[model samples]
Target: MGLKSFLSRPLAAYVAHQYQKWALHPEAAQQRVLQELLRLGPATAFGRDHDLAAARTAPDFQQRVPVRDYEALSPYIERIKQGERDVLWPGQPLYLAKTSGTTSGAKYIPITKDSIGNHINGAKDALLHYVHRTGKPQFLDGKLIFLSGSPELEQVAGIHTGRLSGIANHHVPGYLRRNQLPSYQTNVIDDWEQKLDHIVDETLGQPMTLISGIPPWVQMYFDRLTERTGRPVGEVFPQFQLFVYGGVNFEPYRRKLLDSIGRPVDTLELFPASEGFFAFQDEPGNPGLLLLADAGIYYEFIPAERFFEPNPPRLTLAEVELDRNYALVVSSNAGLWGYSVGDTVRFVSLRPHRVLVTGRIKHFLSAFGEHVIGEEVEQTLREALQQFPEAEVVEFTVAPRVSDTATEPSRHEWLVEFARPPHNAAAFAAALDAGLRRRNVYYDDLLRGNILAPLQLTPLPAGAFQRYMKSQGKLGGQNKVPRLSNDRVLADGLLRA
Candidate 1:
């Protein structure tokens, strides 16, 4: 047997055990996880402050610890950074999963050994669970190329910190190290352009079987490979069997992605973040991902409709209803207590719970009180893009234009950089506007009342958004322009580009 296969035996068995437990008694698994977390560091400052030892139930724990974001957790995290032991986790974090997600500026998220192990093991379970269900392992027989972020980490307050993918790349299993493409030197190139070129050069001749990354970055690699080989991606890597993707909604990029790859391949969607790896598409037939309830995270849900409220009632898995959007809050082995991950999702199934990521709680255009969220915008645009089949959306951002004078009324402005602009701009704009109005009652009401002007669309030059991201040093993996924003910072920057 192959070395990877041999090493995978234990993991496969572990996944099997977890799957059985998840299927039969998921709630029991959650209760056990909570107990473990509470018992781990009960004497630490945070633990004692929250009275973790006294908290015997989920409700009691919630009552003890208030929901907080990174800013609120900064004081404890700072202490952890200053070489303090048993601050958040039992000891110092393995590294920090640095990011600039919903809130502005760089965020240094603590990644304990417990948390990083969960990240790696969660991915293993995803692969093993899929193979067990589908009985397909052709992809495993050949090399797997992960087009991800830089692994060359730098020190942050005596702890290593970098992108989550960068940090995880080092921990790749010894058995599969040979099967992974692109040398470590090539993988750590900081410049996106240089890194892209290096990756293409190094991986062009490899016998790739599986390709994994965020959709947009993967699309870039595929496009570049086609350009270099003068052939389709399927031809270039004929053995390619799987495409693993996450980070953003795939609907907008789906058509172009398939078109670039030149054939259908098995696809798995993951809900992985710096904080935790939450879900994965375990079955090809299931449209939503099976929530990894047994993973290290203790999940909570806040109704998106009332998410902005100062103290909205939260629900546990037993109380959540299907088809309702909720802001995800997680208390994890990572030492993040009652932290909102900024993503929103809705349950598609109740038993053996499965969910679909709907949108981001902060990514919305509601400057004029017409609360238009990322989910609504993405859905509307996906339907609208049907009218322009030949055109493909590359990148897009939306901003609210709050006018102070009556002569210049308020409206939402859309800045789109398309691989192929539509034949008719006016029709595309009209279709997009009509779709939004049809989907959102608040938007329709504003249009009817003339409180907001019809949305405007500006077709940016081909590389405008790319250039902007490059300027900000966030061009590649997991770094993306917020699709909808309440402010004009991103919109103005795109215009300047």
Candidate 2:
């Protein structure tokens, strides 16, 4: 190993060991985080307005501040944009993480000096955990490329504003900078296709050991590399050992991705958002992501079934139970109070606060009172894929198809793009429907009552989803096609494609 690789081993071990101190005692760590947030709360307008200074406990804080989405808190955000000091966080934010997918177009999440570490450190620790556990730090000696957004920032009230990934680019550690690939000029290219071409040209012969990006975009890069070199990605980058990904679940693309590489590589899953970096996979074979308990954020949960209720109980870490779906709510040093991140999670291991991202609170199918979550569909697909080993999924989405005619029964429509189409399509569809029926009782009743017809699968061309995303101008950098929708907007779009 080189100097960097040798030094990284001890540093990685120390970081991982330090992290375990908090992860093992989550309730205590969370209490400390809440205390710190409360200490800083009195300095800001939100803190003063919510009477945060008087609040001594999580319940007191919860009673004073109501859970809200971005739209509900935009008034405070607006003041910050107008150069108001202490409107949200103390003084001014270091950066505003720009993201899309809201009805109000882009959302600008505050990244304060106090809270920026949560985003940056969370990513750093994920790698440290991997090196400490697997004892494989040789990747540190070679190029590590992060396929990300343009690092160029736009001014918003004198604050640097851009995609979270872009903002992160400014903070890449000095040590890793030498190993990072795709020159600044190539990274700043606006067109994703052109950017991919440049990246392929830049790294086609480099010693690339680690690749990180959203799975679909990374898959696109893999496709380009193989096509350009007339070799599998493993042959092209023989030293490549790690695939770090976030934004979306990795399972759906797992088979095709590995097939393209022609070998297995260590994969790490992260749960990151504009709001905060919440969790990352810490163990090699575990699907659960270790929640960052002491990472300058106080977490609260409302049972998924009660998420829409007017006064749902906000349960803290001690109150959360295993295997129950909860809507993740967070209050942070970034000045967000009782902010609903729109995600639903299930605690897989309460001892260390490991969770599985089940779905989004707003992203589900309940058009016919048969609520089908993202986890259910993804899990069902996994089960079905196990039965059909030859099948390979590129991407898929589900939407309800409400019938306009009384004689016709409404049904759920699945649009899937296959890298390798199934030999027996009928059997595959049957496996999916059966798996869903077993997992979701409401869907089972709907099927038995004839209220809904069996789900239909519409196969699309190889790159249909990519084409659709490109048309929407969301082709790259943390954008994901919603897995489930109540309306036919996505379904219709895929069908039209």
Candidate 3:
């Protein structure tokens, strides 16, 4: 083995050993994290206003601070944006992770010096887990391509402001800087299409080993590489060993992505967001991601059904159960107190606190009280795709199709874009409908009661989703189309497009 791999093997082993301590004793780790957050809470304005200093225990903290979304916390965020110090966390944050918001248009999430370690270390530990488990660390020797937002930053009240990925770019460790791919000039291009082309040109001849990004964008990169080289991704970059992805479920895009790669590759899934780096897949063949209990974030969960209630019951690590959907809440060292990041999760394993990100809390279909989630749709599609091995899904979304007239029955409409359309589309649709019924009793009851018709599949033109996203100016860098919606706004817009 060469110098890098030889050194990485021991390092990976050491990191994995250190990580397992917290994974094994998650509740203890969480208690410690909570105490640390509580200790730091008194230095900020939000801390003073919420009486965080008076909170001695989890219940005390919960009682003092109510769960809040971005809009609810924007007043303090605005104060920070206007150059105020110690508004949320201590003094000023190192950077602001700007994300697209629903009602607020744009959200600026604080990333303090205290909390940045969670983001960086979570990613490092995930890779280390893979290296230690498989004894394969040669990927570190070649160029690592991270398809991300531009590294360029704009100052917001003396703080560097950009997408979370962009903010992270400034912090890439010096050791790995030599291996990082896609030149800074290429990354700075504003238009995604243009940046992608420049990236392809720059890395076309390089020895790329690791590729990481949101699934869709990485797939796009793979497609461009294959189109240009007239060879599969594996043939083009034989050293490419790892696929690191997050932001969307990989199951839905697995077939197409694998086809593009032209071979099997080890994959790692992360549960990261603007708010914090929450979890990462630590074991091969495991669907669950191990939660970072000691990541300077105190986590809470409210049952998804009772999330909007006047006073939802908040459960901590010790109180949560397996397989129940819960809206994820956190009070991080970054100054967020009892903040709901809008994502819902289901615990698959409680021993090490492993979880699967089920869906967004607001991004569900409850138009007819069926209440289908992103996990259900993605899972149903994944199962349906299995029976029809020939079909390769590119992208898809679902929305309620309610008729204007009373005579017609309402049904769910699935807008799918396929790389390889199924041979028998009707049979595939039937399989998906059956799977949904099997998964959700409410949906099954609606079907049996004749209140809803079987779902309708609309085969969208290839690249239709991309075109739609492009039109919305959300073409790249962590933006994803919702899996399902309660209304026809997205479906109508898609059909019209």
Candidate 4:
């Protein structure tokens, strides 16, 4: 190997060694983490200790806590909204991550110092492990780019001071903090539209080797970059080597991004939220993400088979079966104990403890009582796309809507966009319908009764989702397209001419 490759090999080896050591002894690592959580706070620690103790004593400790939705925690969330300090934890929270959740409106998720540290450490582990696997030098010895949410600190009565993304940004090492692009002091909050334009314009010619953000916003930024430079994105910023994305799935937009850049780029998916950075894709070739089990968070999974049941057992990492879908529940250092964030995941393998995100538990449609899930929809789309190689769905939303004419009381509508006019829209829809029916029997019955009409293939004008996002004041920074819509109002608004 050459000098640069030789130097990187040893670093890669070191990272791999660490990852292997952790993987081999996850229980030991979690036990040590439990001790640390105890040190953080008695109540914070006591909750976990109680659960563990309960698990040890109960016939099936994993089955004790029923699968709960966010509604279960609404009362506590309301207490936080009312300015209560110790509602979730012992002391005043350090910050709140303002996230625009589906339908429930904006939620100010509390984040404490311990939780912040967990996020940082989890990220560090992921990065170190990556360097070890690839043996690639950290391209930017300079600044790192993190296209994050608005850093506006909320000043609500009794609410925390710091914004989630901003607080995380602030926690970066003092020396590296200055290297952050878009200095935190700029009033990028007041004029979001102008700010996005400025961010795109200013960074056009910079030596930014790494870019990270949500997929939708990144696409918008690239679109703007291409417009501004009057050249393809790759020509404007050829040096960018790595793109790190988190908070949403990037699979659907992968091809578009590759086309824009003119070449394949290294992409890393991070499983992070306001709660904590739970996992990351350890190696580019790995099938599932490696969980940061050592982070100050305890994880549980509700098996897919029991997901809709009134009370589904919550299995720990060890108790969970491999290759089955499960709803993720987390008890973190952020004071969220036995919390179900609504995201769904499945284990691709168990020996290495790697997991793949299947879908959001709440983002499914089962109006026919068939229990259709996000994974089923994703799989159906994947199969349909493979059959019709000429067609590409730019954006889509699936929902149960009744026909206004009352002929079909219950029918499913899919608002979809194609790259260009399909050779046969009807055939494409039929293929999708067949795929769905085969994968989910309930959908088949619904289709037979015309309860679910032939999937409506609506061709969205180019940049339609982008335009919608801009109108919603979420043009840039960590915002993504709504993958599934249950309500008719938002769906109709999105579909309207």
TM-score, one value per model = 0.74, 0.76, 0.76, 0.67
Clashing pairs in 3: none
Error of 4 at 360 (Å): 1.0
Any idea how many clashes model 1 has? 0
Predicted structure 3: lDDT: 0.85
Error of 1 at 4 (Å): 4.6
Model 3 C-alpha lDDT per residue in residues 370-484, reported as the tens digit of each score: 5477777888999999999999999999988754332565789999999999999999999999988877755775576455789999999978888888989999999999998
Give the TM-score comparing model 1 with the true structure, all chains together.
Answer: 0.74
Error of 1 at 224 (Å): 0.7
- lDDT string for model 2 (173-283, tens) is 999998898999999987666788999999988999999987656877887898898998999999999999987655556786888899888888999888999999999
> Each candidate: what lDDT?
0.79, 0.87, 0.85, 0.65
Clashing pairs in 2: none
Ranking of all candidate structures by their lDDT, best first: 2, 3, 1, 4
lDDT-best of 2 and 3: 2
Candidate whose lDDT is highest: 2
Worst 10 residues of 4 by lDDT: 53-62
> Residue by residue across 1-497, what tens digits does model 1's lDDT show?
45565556566667767787675566777887888888885867789788888988888988998888777888897787787877877878889887643222356788887788778877777888777766666577688988777788999778998878888798887666888877898887755567778888977877788888876567667767887889889889888888888876676568878887788888888888888989888777687888878778888999999998988887888889999999999998888899987779999987688899887777776554455667678877898788888778988888877654325756789899889888988889999999888766556645764556898898898789988899899999999789888677788888888
Error in Å for residue 38 of model 2? 0.9
* Predictions: Cα RMSD each: 13.8, 14.0, 14.0, 14.2
lDDT value, residue 76 of candidate 4:
70
